[model samples]
Target: MAIIHYFAPMMKMRIFGLVFLGMAAACYNPPRNCNDFKEGEFRFTTVVGENEQTTTFIRRKSIEIDYYQEKADTSSIRWINDCEYVVKKINPKTPAEEKSIHMKILSTTDSSYTFEYGLVGSSKKSRGTAFKVN
Candidate 1:
């Protein structure tokens, strides 16, 4: 009887903790309206060897045009879904450029999105954020 009395309070605390966690989990929802970003003019900035580089791109239904380093490059887009897509350069100049890149939209805001990108068929991924320009 004494053992039961001592454990009762601990069991009640464990039950309360679980119920609180469940409620918190049920109330949280992540923003993922990916279609809002499917077609837009956006800018992405990254650091390259101490130099800040920016790429501006315009995406349409099945195509994207990127402006970087005073050059415009066009790529064909194959969307796996609303949040995932593959991009292949239309006129790749080198062997490295010939590889396709896989991109996934990880999260979004009112005028920007965070994304993960990597070479197609590769396990490595890098993340970046792009802000809408239009």
Candidate 2:
């Protein structure tokens, strides 16, 4: 009986803490203005090996053109929704390039959006940020 008395307050405190955390999580929402990024010129930079590489892309309603390493690649954009799309290269040079990429806009700020992308049928995913240029 004494041990139960000693631990009862601790158990109550834990339950209160958990309830507070759950309420906070339920009230939180990240800002996502995915429609604003639907059509625009954007820049994405990533590190490759020991060098920083940048890719610039222009997105229209159904197409996207990417310029990287002095080369331009065109891809068709099939929007699953305002925040999700699949990109397929128009003329893929390799088998890997022929695979379409699934992209999802995770969150956004005034001029940039964070996205997660991966191959259409793959479980692996990667994240990147793209800043709008126009």
Candidate 3:
């Protein structure tokens, strides 16, 4: 009976510790500077086919022009909020490219923002961090 009493308090303490740790982890938050990223020249680097590829884009009020792999394409931007927008290829060459991409800024730093984007209405998402170049 005495050993059972001692173990009961120990179990409670362990459970309480776990709960406190969970709460502390939940409190962590990332930074965002949506307005600063709204209009700028930015660079994004991603791994493609085992090679690091970089793309540059200039975003204005409602349009974005991207230069990638020696090709330039224009896209239209529709802002849903300060930190979210949808982008569609201005002149899509294929049906797949006609899908609009939904982008949300998840976090930001002094000169960059981490974002997640996917085709609108799709469940799969891709994340990337973009840095302001100018």
The models' CA-based lDDT, in order, is 0.96, 0.97, 0.97
- TM-score attained by model 3: 0.85
Q: Provide the lDDT at 16 for model 1.
A: 100
Q: Write the per-residue lDDT of candidate 1 for residues 22-78, one digit (tens) a residue.
A: 999998866878999999999999998999999999999999999999999999999
Off by over 4 Å in 3: 1-18
TM-score of each: 0.86, 0.86, 0.85
Residue-level lDDT of model 3, residues 19-95, one tens digit each, is: 99999999988987799999999999999999999999999999999999999999999999999999999999999
Candidate 1 global CA lDDT score = 0.96
TM-score of 2: 0.86
> What lDDT is reached at residue 103 by model 1?
97
